[model samples]
Target chain A: MAPLRDPALEEISEALHAAPGAETITRLSAIDAVRARILLAIEHRLYAPGEQLPPLEALAEGLDVAPITARRALETLVEDGALVRRRGRGGGTFVAASPPQIQDSAVNVFRADEDAIRLLIDQRCLMESALVAAAAERITVEECDDLEALVDAAEQATTWAAFHSADRRFHRRCAELSGLVEATSYQTTYEMLARYFLPYPLDRLGGSHREHRAIVEALRAGDGSRAATTTREHVGSLRRDMFMALPR
Target chain B: MAPLRDPALEEISEALHAAPGAETITRLSAIDAVRARILLAIEHRLYAPGEQLPPLEALAEGLDVAPITARRALETLVEDGALVRRRGRGGGTFVAASPPQIQDSAVNVFRADEDAIRLLIDQRCLMESALVAAAAERITVEECDDLEALVDAAEQATTWAAFHSADRRFHRRCAELSGLVEATSYQTTYEMLARYFLPYPLDRLGGSHREHRAIVEALRAGDGSRAATTTREHVGSLRRDMFMALPR
Candidate 1:
């Protein structure tokens, strides 16, 4: 929920490391994979602050890892302030209400693969197009108005994290409006792609806000075909208009 | 995997129980939910036959179930002949290489939810369309030949299980041809919907083999749009054609 580091500082860091469409990191080690998965779950709010993680044995099983490996992942996360361990009765490891914004590099795992990035983009386009078409058919006037309000909120958001939170809600609303059960898969795909996203400046995010409004207009008119086109244009522009699509 | 029950008899059973589009069962109990998850994992081949399963503590953790509850689910699965146990060295509960085919009703859990079925279908449509389109862009003639062979294999399959096996491979090939790293997500989405699939007659399956050939033709011609359209029409027809659409 906080910036990974100072915005200007991080941008400069990213620019320095820019490799231009090359593999950004080596393949993830298994321990790093586990650590990243748990971190993602926290960011995804699967484990809310104050929520207890499953016991280490269970966590290991869930992750299909050895108990010692799971223990090591927990130790690193706790040390970085992402998780906490409490002992004695009625106590266990818990997500830190304020997980330290340490310079943990585990979350960088997703950007390592060129093929995954391409696949996710293609997958997102397909799912987003389908969802937007469906939403145009079913979204109510009230829902459209609520969507506009979300757009306004994002435009006014003060921080990268706040913008991100609203951005997720806005896209999730598009999927939900489709009134389809499998819309949940859209979120899963979206999150996987989002992991590859580096932070964007607020003003650049504001540029994207216009496309969001255009999508709402198409939905309000109940034009599925137009909405789908508008949606594709929006997603396609993601690589160019904002976010990381460069050699970084 | 063994047939869920007597093949001929189950077909007749399916006919009698068919409601044409109604929810046939109540909501899944949590234990049944866990049971279904494990069964699906087996069917997906994540845990191979004769492979040892995680210990109770780990399995429970992985499933987010209490140890007692996880035990009950495993017990029911074992009783149904889907799993087995052996004592002593390297011994734990294992998937029965020749697990007995029992009329265990837990596999029916997925069909209980109308929304989930529809969602899975929608989600599949999006992902499959994307994968097929990407496949057309990248498939080599040799890969196309391999796909044609899989289609042929499905045509020759004598049992529903055999057809199902080839069917999985054929679709998986579509994703793999794209050479996209996240193509694995396609398999995940496919298996989730497959959990809701009812067995179709082999002849009925044979009738659907035509579409597979059409898809291959489009891919071989390097026609991405055509391949994608053919894929959509093929998936769309699933509701009315080969698979379940009636309220049973």
Candidate 2:
């Protein structure tokens, strides 16, 4: 494949990392970029999960930032639970074995670009559909039963954050069943971008909860296509119901 | 979502990045890790496409490697066309707008782990099917004709690398039609692992070329399911036909 990045996405990437982008897009600090760089290293596996990083001085120098800048960036990421540091010998700084999903402090990029947002949704629809179908084919009756608990957990969640967290568990469990390592991992990493785009709401919860249950039932019946269809419809609805899709 | 990583995947990430995992895994020096970290920054959007990076001294210290080691790593990546360097004022180090696919000097990691290979293949299948369907929904009659050219480009390729390159152009074009930025980006990055797993050969060229042509036809007819089914079958065949599947 040519690996040609879409022109719009190329701009989004710039907006994400630079201060010189289109007006209205929030500007990021050098420190933010540094933290993002280190986090990217972990997400991309350049810095293995749980591997100790270089000394602060070395890290700061190599990154070409003031030592204070590197130190602060690292500290923020640590606060986000993306990294963990320990004192004494045999410890400097380490990528979290299982890093928490980062909440982007900047969501303006998504808010400002409707066309890019549409593509984002489409891309997600493609991935989520395939993952659900792949998972359906591999999900067993017992696993289907486990997925039900996850579904109910979302429906019963009292808050938007709670529901979103539970909702992801349901999907994550399905992806686990598929055993597609990189596909699943790709989805996981993509969420760092995906999650920040929409502030959660219980506004569409009832309908979404129904779809979740429907997907599980389809999986239980070994109907991969049916599960995939519901998944597509669910994500496709984002075009009508997502933040940008509403009055905004 | 939960973003819970599977234990097997966790191991693969570590294997891909570190030298201390499976005995059969090739060792990566500090310099290799340095190159990877910098590359990850680009892929993760922390560095951004075409963004300028820090001076060599700062870069060397930030990553905690010797200056010479940093220099060599930077040079190799630049030679690979992943980065571009210019001398004098207003020039330092910049990530290439469109970087080339990296060839991992190491494939032993994939060879040694049969299970991970299966998952990687499954992940690709998931992505390809969805991307095909997504493209089908959006593909124009004119675009279908362009896809035909890509199919032929792959078929007429005289070498494995040429065919792979042409073949990727076809897929990348399809993803562009969908506009899913992170999903496409995730796939591009995942290939760093996926591409290295199997050394290219003319072994399965004929069938692959046929599938490529058929997928384009399915798009021409706007038959998303047909396109998706064919994709799944073609990728499924890899589980049976890949090198790991071959009797040693």
Candidate 3:
């Protein structure tokens, strides 16, 4: 994929500036800005896996950023296992394929489930619980409607893949509604893992749909505890469904 | 940190190639070879945080690999979050400043009770238990000696910081002994967090020392279960000590 700029990041940065006085604005350092730009580029597949990046000077010119700033951005990517580099006569930078292996010994099981699918569901639950707790105090009317629509879409999904995709989107939108960007970003790894192990089961879709509905109903009724409770149950069901789909 | 290749990686790759027979020689793919080279360089702090990497073409020439191949290596670095890229006048790649946040939750209260510290200790127990179980069937004599020395160093430490440092080394060495590099990497993160948050109570250091002796003795006896148990109890004492030191 071609490398492209992410206007959304700039838009978000602008919104942050406008929402607060200039004194309160937290401008990203050049390195962070460059790093975020590259991540966005990867997410959008503007720079697809296995593609070579332009020369450092060319990249700096294209991004309208300083060479050092771009350099840090690339370094951050490498640390995250998103890119690799080498030096010599015929070498240049290129995009990396796949993701890095995150070691998960029992000591640091992050969220404490063994199976990848189970961890994915638990992770979503933890984030949703945090978000719904906050959203109950501040969810906007428009957001409430949007959440309900997502639940409806999931409920109407005919196949497992469609239902699963909708399910993630529904939960993700909930996190968005809560207005916590970092929490949303934290789930990116889980999302990537989920994609890697796609074509999960549909037999348990009905159970998930019901749970999703309960969560929506609770949100509509402005009950934080109920929303959390429903979300927990829903996540539990997803965990079971995921395990069932896997061959022992 | 100078920007250079990782000597250890180079040595290992060379050793693998020098193993003589094709059967003994394991050739890494070009991408992996370059990636390993970069990691070795970075891990040894060849590229310090914020240090600019060599130009892509320059790197390619030095490595005697095609420019595209070199670019792929750089891309792998980017993917790993080690480096960032820029496009403009005087732009280049550079190392990342801070490590990525490992999606750790505040599950181990580490504060609520002696239970809090003990719970985290229990996690270490579980991890080490798994490691020992694996290691009993896999450890080499040299690794056992490393573990023994690490334990001795911890026992000899006087200050809280020194003891904690040695304690981390001991536990990490134990994992390394298990021949599970990936799991041991996770153990490194666990050790970092534990060391960061768990303060040592100097007065109780003697008890911890005895526990370490017990663990080593168990390992010497080739009793995996006993070694695992001893390690858990040893970590448990540290937890209890932390509890007593907590602000009343």
Candidate 4:
């Protein structure tokens, strides 16, 4: 697969080239630039997820900068969710998931699970309601097929983990149907973290799948409020279940 | 001010110490472990915001590991939004922010502008309603003071920027009071981004301050629905104002 490049890479590279800093060119300023480069590097698959990063010496050499400069640059990427570091024997650098496609990028950079997964689900519930409402108002014919297939996958899955994965795909599909792909990163972060905090059992999947069908039906009939309400319950139930299962 | 430390630093240090081999950990595995370290570091201010990081060699030496191992550990911290780096001259690593403190952390992570900010505010409206409802059912006296003070700050502000700053504090305080500090990051992210992208003229301060008073009164009265509704309008107006300033 072609590696993805960060949307911000070209802008920074261009800025770096355009900057008239003959003396200070070797120094780094604005940690965002370093982060942008790392993100771009990851997107390009120059550094694959779970793959160790080049030694700080190598990276500094490649970027034509100092080891501390390279080290700090990598550290910024770590802060931005583009890189991960390990310590101890055999520990090395690796890529994390691509930074979420953000529609609103002005907010402070979120470290994954900083808000934890539960809070992300709560936000997802809010966004899902709006997404369903939007999909009800304007879901394409092809999109309906996609949604059906996701639901079908969920129903066919026998294991809890598989069903949970399908459930995530189904909701993600719904969000995409609403034409909000750029906003998925915020929600995706939550779901990914939620995996660590609350793993769902397979038996809890049936009811939500049935509810998904109802939401689809509501969308088919152009009943936006109904579709939105149903979608809210569907996603909210996931949060509710996790909350109930919270270690007492 | 002393920089905030991430909360997971010590745990990660321990984990790294306990790991058995040189095999690189799995993607999420290393990501989560390093993430814990970054957070703990932030909590402890080991990596202060805007401060340069030690050279990669130094980190490796301190951790008693290979330079390659140190690279991986730092890489993960970058991805987790706990650090920022620069390259060339005058650049190194710096801590990003401590969690549970909203604006600084959330704003840097997400970008919220006019169109995107509107959607986020709308999302906030939904969450605020639910949060306030939950708070009404369960909130403390000390939390109430924090909420009230935020409103007072908003009312006393003289500039639109100052008012907006106080306004954010008010809403975030409400979220904190709701005892869902975890869920409030999204809202905090929105508020912080809005402050940056939707700066108002200095003249518009009073109107927002008035809205602040009304929302606070509602919360003070234990009127969850009223607090929810009023807060929605308050945020919705900011969104509307921002959209009005947009081209086309």
Candidate 5:
């Protein structure tokens, strides 16, 4: 019911209003949107564990919403156990010391049948290919070196945990290099969905590393299309591996 | 924080508690999530314009949330001008008569640069290809005939508006035929974003129709891969057209 307060928010609202047959989103919707963004930030580790978020007023101004709206958003996070609000002169809102863990059953979040799983895999293939293509065009030499290092780390990983960590960083770095912040943000969602299919067999590590190496090499060569193609194949291979690993 | 009341709600809560590094989504969060799903249903025309929604109690039972949570969710929509809440024995929440229009600026929802747009297009390419592949494998003769009718309608369309509607139905039908409900649901989000790039020139219609015919042929022949490839090309062409139409 609140009037448009921020110009950016107003622009977004106006766009939604103009969309034919689209339902209107109100200022209250902004509260949810802001909350989701902050939660995503925390989930992605953009806000490190135990890190304090900006004061409510500052967050409100930054998001161009009323202080009450920002406060409500933060309160939702607090209620959700994603954040801890401290009182006293030095106290503020902080990322929870312990955030909720995504259970193995988190795949249930997809509420998807096997067909939907395949569809999700298909989506990932396309999205990752695009990320690699964009990264190939814009990735700096330094970023390329970072990717190489991640691949090398994965190759040497004696434990599946270490290998998986490096593998996630490798893919996430590619998204970051693509210079699409939203895409990078979305990579977290993809990874969360992927957690269910993980703990890939140690035997598959060698093959996976090889695929990662090919992706990095293609990026190093600045061949966008090649990078994209290789990335697609790489994701396809993972999908195959997942299907094989699932219990019959 | 209200305690979980229903056994089902408690089970979900316990699952969240078991998850590591995930935020706990509380009942209030459910309100927002339910609100979003309902809004999406309305936007996708699952809930037709002017149709009264099921009572809050029914909705709550369906979503397995508290009645209050469902009420709050509907109230949020009411505040947002997406729904009308009326009192009296026969009155209920109805979709607003004039739903908010998404302004041309609604593309701002992506908060994306050009790269994000390209990534989105790539995503569509992959998704559509998968849908077509599934459709190719499973499309009944009746469904194929329906698709043919849609193509014919598009071919005969005199205005871009008419053609666009047929085009949308064609794509949606492909997803529906895939028998992946979640994937079909996701198609709405893709379509919402695609709206920003709509209204193909009259000259482009013939070529577009030809592409559609090729897709339908591939489906009729039960050539899944070919259908997939053709669908990908079709989406790619649309992406190209969109890019060309954008102001330099």
Candidate 6:
């Protein structure tokens, strides 16, 4: 197949090559780029479980890559247990019935380096602080109420599992209320980084709930500075708590 | 060759596949992962320009991937203009004599979406704020002097080009002074994002220099909060300035 004639892609390519004195370019091969897009789509649930992917030829045509390239990409996914291929009538590639679990080892790699963990925390602090500030400025009373309700649900949670679920929802809702589409991606990435620090101590739940309450109050009052400060402190506390709990 | 059996590769693969309840696991082909690692190393200058890479067989052995996979990874790099392969004796893979410029298209892809640009700025604000705060608390007198020197250089700069170079140095030095190794990577990523909005109008150079002076003063005084505020404002101003300059 001829390379896809995508104007956006072409524009990107031109900008990279033509930028004067450009030293180095960060790039992905055609196959890798296609794979990344498909993976992202699947992660976002654009393709439901057990969904059949288009035939190799059609998939290759859509992405504007050779069929061999597309097949290689699919093969890689198959190796990762993300897809299964079958032959015969009505047989083709399908999302795996049960995709392999992200090995603990993978998460371990992210959490492996002490410095990386701290950096991740620093990054989260920065993104969330800005997000809270924006949310405070734009959140309506109804959205404030929604956040308060999530906080209440967390406070009343009888199990760690239930409380954790509420905690995730509250933070996510806060991002949504910020009215920035980009915050959603930040929130998603933040959640992934946080997975390594999950099952926060039950004893600290009360304090955490209070912190959430403070954030909601700040948002309700349209106090951007206060919202940012509270968010920073809350996230900072997580980092502190995690570091302190690590074995010496 | 049988899949190169390296403990490190096995660890990574197991970690990827073994995470419990991993509904979706994002992965790279062995070739892609190896390529990414080598590329990152090159970008970081682990392999300087003009440096010759080890033979393909050795690289394959080191990464514990099949020799063919390792060869494919190198081939991809060659295709990207990151490396050159020569034929006959004394020829292996060497860093390209003159690497292809990172295409303007790649940078444009980053700057194409207005919201993505904004999100990038917000992320930078957060990280830099935290970084400056830390730097304020811990920066030594010698480090403070070093920063002041950079600021002075910017102020004395007769040309916009000179000022821009000093400006980049000043910001990078700030991250380094923070005593956080991770901050350096954040600073690098932030600079790449900022490149698209560069070539500050000559009129704004003086104002930008003053902001740098204020940040230096805050660092000198060991005022973490003030340093954070000043740094945040400085970065925020860049975002504001760029947005205002964009065509309506």
Best by lDDT: 1
Ranking by DockQ: 2, 6, 1, 5, 4, 3
Superposed model 6: Cα runs more than 4 Å off: A1-119, A129-152, A159-161, A169-248, B1-115, B134-146, B158-161, B176-182, B194-197, B200-204, B217-226, B243-245
Q: Which prediction has the highest TM-score against the true structure?
A: 2
Q: Write the per-residue lDDT of candidate 1 for residues B1-248, one digit (tens) a residue.
A: 22223222222223222322333313456687678767765664556688778778766654556889879998988888899988899888999997654444555534334344554566677777666766786789999999999999989976655677788889888988866543665665566556455444455665468889999999999876567667767776665542235422
Query: TM-scores across all candidates?
Result: 0.44, 0.46, 0.32, 0.39, 0.40, 0.45
lDDT of all predictions: 0.66, 0.62, 0.52, 0.52, 0.60, 0.62
Question: Which of 2 and 3 is the better model by TM-score?
Answer: 2
Q: Please give the ranking of all candidate structures by TM-score, highest first, separated by commas.
A: 2, 6, 1, 5, 4, 3
lDDT of 2 at B76: 78
List, for all models, the DockQ compared with the true complex.
0.06, 0.08, 0.01, 0.04, 0.05, 0.08
Candidate 4 structure quality by residue, lDDT tens digits, A1-248:
12223232222122222212222222225344345445544444445566666666655543444678768767766766667888899887777755543221211122222323344566766556656665666787777877888888878875544566676677767766765433354353334333232223345456888998998788778766667568667766755454333332
lDDT of 5 by residue, B18-88 (tens): 21222321222556546655665555454667877766665565445689987987787888788998889
TM-score for chain B considered on its own, for each of the candidates? 0.57, 0.57, 0.47, 0.48, 0.53, 0.53
**CAPRI quality band, candidate 5:** incorrect
Q: Which ten residues in a row have the lowest lDDT in candidate 6 chain A?
A: A13-22
Cα shift from native, residue A94, model 3 (Å) = 40
lDDT of 6 by residue, A71-133 (tens): 887898888888888889989999887666434222233233334345456667656765676
Tens-digit lDDT track of model 5 for A62-149: 4456899879878877887888988998899998988774331212222222333444455666566656766776787888898999
- Residue-wise lDDT of candidate 3 within B216-241, one digit each (tens)? 66666666656655665665454444
Better of 3 and 4 by DockQ: 4
Which should have the higher TM-score, number 2 or number 6?
2
Q: What is the lDDT of residue A169 in candidate 4?
A: 74
Give me the TM-scores for chain A across all models, comma-separated: 0.57, 0.57, 0.48, 0.49, 0.53, 0.54
